[model samples]
Target: MQVVTTIAGSDSGGGAGIQADLKTFQELKVFGTSVITALTAQNTLGVSGVMPIEASFVEQQLQALLEDFSISAVKTGMLFSSAIIQTVAQMTANTKVPLIVDPVMIAKGGESLLRQDAIDAIINHLLPVATIVTPNIPEAETLTGKEINTLADIKEVAKLLLQTGVQCVIIKGGHLADRNFAIDYIFFKNGQSFSMQTPRIASKNTHGTGCTFSAAITAFLGSGLPIKEAIIEAKKFIQLAITYDLALGNGHGPTNHFAYQNYKETCEVIIHES
Candidate 1:
């Protein structure tokens, strides 16, 4: 089986971070490995606390994994501090593996998962080595220091992000003002771009959407799909995950990570102009 690794935090809530990434990798039929960067005390209601793992230990975990497995792809989620971000960047920078960076900054309950100082580390060190960087609207704004109010704004932010040396950028549009359909715009450094949209489902169980979406892309990439096809499949994966809600938590619940695997045949891809 193709092996993939996630360098991220662990959520006690089991709805996001490493939990969501591992669940996604499993559903996509890839062998999953992980290096935990932090431990979060959280539930569906909210995050109460976070304990960041030491940078040295994070390096050790990655080193041990690198010594053994042939990791086909790697995705990073919540590197809470600049130290940990630097450590992860150093470990993954020279490798030829496809890297998917999920710029996870805040939780659904408004808890900050990334430190204010770590943004520079991510942009300068991590993003330069990333194959694709997935950022939501707010994260994109934070990265580019610009407001994103329209589709044109998203295109501009994507162009700025590509200058960071990432091969591609995916700016998710769930936070945009549109309430009808969820749109995601993908831009490649080669000047190719496209947007995908699906009818927005009115549900509260959307906690781990970004993590799961990026993890699906990692899984597809590990399984030998090209970047464009991997993203297309990942889009379908998340659409099914969100559409078939798990309804487990009191607040923002998680997407059904198994939904895509169970209903792959019927899950259709919707590409539309926003």
Candidate 2:
């Protein structure tokens, strides 16, 4: 089995962050390991508090995993502090494994997950080493210091991010205003670009969608899928997960991590019967 690691914060709510990443990895049939950079006291409603683990401990965890496990790919989310972000960038600097950086800045409940001061560290250090960086509109705006009210703006930001040395930039357009469709733009290092649009699902149960989407990409990459193919698969997976949302919490619930497998099985059965 392919082993994929998540270096992210722990979501006590089991809806996002490391919890969501591990759940997505397992649902995608990959073995998942994790290094908790921080812990959040949060639930469906909002984040109450956060406690970042020591940078040294985070480094130790990564070292242990790298020494023993044959990690195929890695994904990072919610590195809450500059110390954590710097540590992660340094440790992964030499690894050949694919790294997917989920630039998780704010939460669905309007809480800041990444410290404002740490944003520069991520852009300067982490982005250069990333195989792909997945950032939503707000994150892209924060990273590039530009407004993303239009597709052209997103494209320009992608270009700027590519100049920072990342192999690929995927700016998720889910947060775009006045749109019936959620469009995501992918800009490759080779000057290739494309946009994918899916009808925007109207639901509040999208608490962990970003983390889950990035984790799915990491899992597919660990299983040997190319970056574009992995992203395509991950997009489908998140769409189904959101479509089959569990509606667990009163406020912004979570996307169904198991929905992809269940939907695939259901489709197979229908095909066989027909």
Candidate 3:
């Protein structure tokens, strides 16, 4: 089995961060490992607290994983401090494995996950080594210091991010105002790009959508899928997961990671009956 690692914070809510990443990786049929950079006391309603693990400990975890397991691909989310971000960047600098950088800056309840000062560290150190950088609309805006109001604006931000040395940039347009569908722009460093659209689901159970989406992409990449194909498959996986959310919590609930399997079985049954 392919082994993919997630270097991210632990979401006590089990709805996002490392919990969500591991769930998505497992659902996608990949072995998952994790290095917890921080822990959040949060649930569906909001984040109550955040405690960042020591940078040395984070590096130790990374070293242990790299020594014992052959990590095929890695995804990072919610690195809370600049020190942690720099440590992750340094440790992964020499590895040839594909790295998926999920620039998780804020939480579902509008809590800041990444430190404001750490953004520069991620842009200067982490992004240059990323195989793919996944950022939501606000994150892209923060990273590029620009306002995104249209597809053209998103493309321009993608170009600016590419100049930072990432191989591919995926700007998620989930936060677009007054949009009936969620559109995502995928831009490759070599000047190729495409857009994906899914009818926006009207549910509050989208707590971990970004983390799950990026984790799915990492799983596919670990399984040897091409970048574009991985993005497409990941997008489909998230759409299905969102479409069949469990609606567990009082606030923003978590996406159903197993929804894809349920979807596949339903399709198979329908095909057999037909």
Candidate 4:
């Protein structure tokens, strides 16, 4: 099995953050490895406390993994501060491996996972080196300084992010004008575009869709799939995850990661572009 590494925070909730990432990797048949940036006292209720792993320890964990694991690709989630962001960027700079950077700013239950000051650091240090940057509307607004209200807004947002040197950018359209359809646009730096549309399931069980999507991308890339194919595969995986999911927490419940098995027909994936 191909080895993939996730550099992120640990969620006690087993929903979003590193837990979801690892679960996505496992479900997709990748050997998962992780270097935790912080440990949080969190559940489906909310994040109670966050204890950051020191920069040295984070560095050691990453170095040890890269030294031994032959990581095929890497993904990042919650880096709590500018210093931690810089450390992660520096560590991955010379490695020249594919990286998926999820700009996780706010939790589903409205908690700050990233600091405001760290935005500039991620824009400067990490985005340029990212193979792809996945940002939801709020994060896209922060990165591009644009109001995302329409399809054109999403396209421009993708354009602005690509200017920062990211090879591909996906601007999630969940917060867009579409209320029933979940629309997300993936734009290559060269202006090629692929838009994914799915019926938005009206359930609160979408706790970790973003984390799972990006981790699926990393897993596909770790297995040597092309970028477009990886994203297409990841999107189909998330759609199934959201379809038959259980509403577990009082807050948004965890997505049913195994829902793919039931609807193999609808969940059937075409990795290459149709």
Candidate 5:
């Protein structure tokens, strides 16, 4: 089994964050573990409150996992503070596991997730160490200091973000409100780029899609798929998960994590002795 660790926040709504990550791992057949940085009192409506776990506690969780588990890949979401971001970056730097940094800066409800004070540390430290950073339109704007009006703008931002030392950037169009079309662009750190387009599904059950997308990529990489292939498969899986929507919450609902899962595999992830 490919063991994947998700270092992220917890969503009590059970639609986003670590909850969605574990579900995606199960659907992709990877063994999942997690280190929660914070806890959210959120629902379909929106986040009501946040209780950030101690930064030391977050570090300890990662320490325990790194010392005990054979984690093949890691995905992170919603690091709520500079302390948590710093801790994760330092802890992951010496490890060989592929890391997917989901720069979850904003919520589906138009609220900020990443603190402005922590933005500097994320760019200078955390983002540079990530294997890939998945950011939506607004988050990209925040990181790149440019407006994403066209596909060219999207590619440019991804390229600039790549220069930050992340292996690649996947600029998501999930938050595009134009309602005419939807597209996601992937830019490799090697100066290559690709775009995939799909028609917009008019569904309100869109919460946790980002979490699922990042988690799926982590899971695929854990299964030994190459980065591009892993991203492609993850994209397809997330699309199906969104297509087979489970109408649960009053606000944006959750995607069906098990929608396209039909096969079961025994986990065979192995670790080398250091």
Candidate 6:
């Protein structure tokens, strides 16, 4: 079986961090491993507290995993501190495996997942090694110091992200003003770009959508799919997951991770050259 590792925070609510990532990896038929960077006291409502693990301990966990498992790909989520982000960057710098960096900055309930000081760490350390960096609009704005209000701005932000040394960038355009359709912009350092558009599913159970989407991409990449195909497939997986909502929590609930297995055949994703 293909093995993928998620280095992210642990959400006690089991919706939007390493828990969601593991669930996504399992559903996508990849063996999942994890090194938790922090523990979050959060539910569907909001994040109550976060306790970051020491950077040294986080490194030790990563070292143990690398010594034993041949991780095919690695995805990073909420690295809450600069120390933890730097440690992850250093540990994975030589892995030569596909690295999916999810710039997880804010929660759905408006709580900050990453520290302001750590944003620079991500740009300086993590992005340099990332195979693909996925950032939502707000996170992209924070990373690039530019606001995204139009399609042109989104494209500009994607371009700015490429200068960070990442092989590719996917800016999630879910926060775009257009609610009729949700679009994600994908750009590569090789000067190719594509737009993946889907009819937005109106649902509150989108708590782990970003984590699940990035995890799916990591899983597909580990299974030997080409990068473009991996990203398209990941988008389909997330669309299905969002479509078949489990509606578990009162606030923003988790997507149905298993939805892809059942509804993938019926799902449709549209991609166009940009």
Task: Pick the TM-score winner.
Answer: 6
**How well does candidate 6 score on lDDT at residue 3?**
89
- Candidate 6 segments whose C-alpha is farther than 4 A from its true place: none
Over 1-274, each residue of candidate 2 has an lDDT whose tens digit, in order, gives 9999999999999999999999999998999999999999999999999999999999999999999999999999999889989999988877888999999999999999988889999989998889999999999999999998887898899999999899999998898884677878889999987777777889999998999999999999999998888888888889888888999978999899988987854321100010
TM-score of each: 0.98, 0.95, 0.95, 0.95, 0.93, 0.99
The lDDT of each candidate is: 0.93, 0.90, 0.91, 0.86, 0.85, 0.93
Q: How good is model 4 by TM-score?
A: 0.95
Q: Write the per-residue lDDT of candidate 5 for residues 1-274, one digit (tens) a residue.
A: 7789999989999999999999999988899999999899999899988888999999999999999988999999999999999999999987878999988877788777888887888888888889989898988999878898887788778878888899989988876766855677888877777766666778889898999999999999999999988887787777777777989978989888887674223211121111
Give per-residue CA lDDT, model 4, range 1-274, as digits (tens).
Answer: 8999999999999998899998988888899999999998887778899898887899999999988978899999998889889999988877888999999988888889888899999999999889999999998998778988777788778888898899999887677766778877889987788778888778878887888889989999999999988888888888898888877878888987777556646764322221
Residues 1-274, model 6: lDDT tens digits: 9989999999888888999999998988999999999999999998999999999999999999999999999999999999999999988988999999999999999998899999999999999989999999999999999999998898888888899899999999898888799999999999999999999999999998999999999999999999999999999999998998898978999988988998888888898996
lDDT per residue (tens digit) for residues 91-111 in model 3: 887788999999999999999
* Model 6 pairs in collision: none
Q: After superposition, which runs of candidate 5 have C-alpha atoms over 4 Å from their true positions?
A: 177-180, 262-274
lDDT of 1 at 127: 91
What residue runs in model 2 are displaced by over 4 Å at the alpha carbon?
Answer: 264-274
Ranking by lDDT: 6, 1, 3, 2, 4, 5
**Relative to the unseen true structure, what is the C-alpha lDDT of residue 173 in candidate 1, on a scale of 0 to 100?**
88
The total number of steric clashes, by the backbone 3 Å criterion, in model 2 comes to 0
**Per-residue lDDT for 223 in model 4?**
97
lDDT of model number 2: 0.90
Q: Which regions in candidate 1 have their CA more than 4 angstroms from the true location?
A: 272-274
Pick the winner on lDDT between candidates 1 and 3: 1
Model 6 clash number:
0
Write out the backbone clash pairs for model 5.
1-267, 1-268, 1-269
Candidate 3 wrongly placed segments (more than 4 Å): 264-274
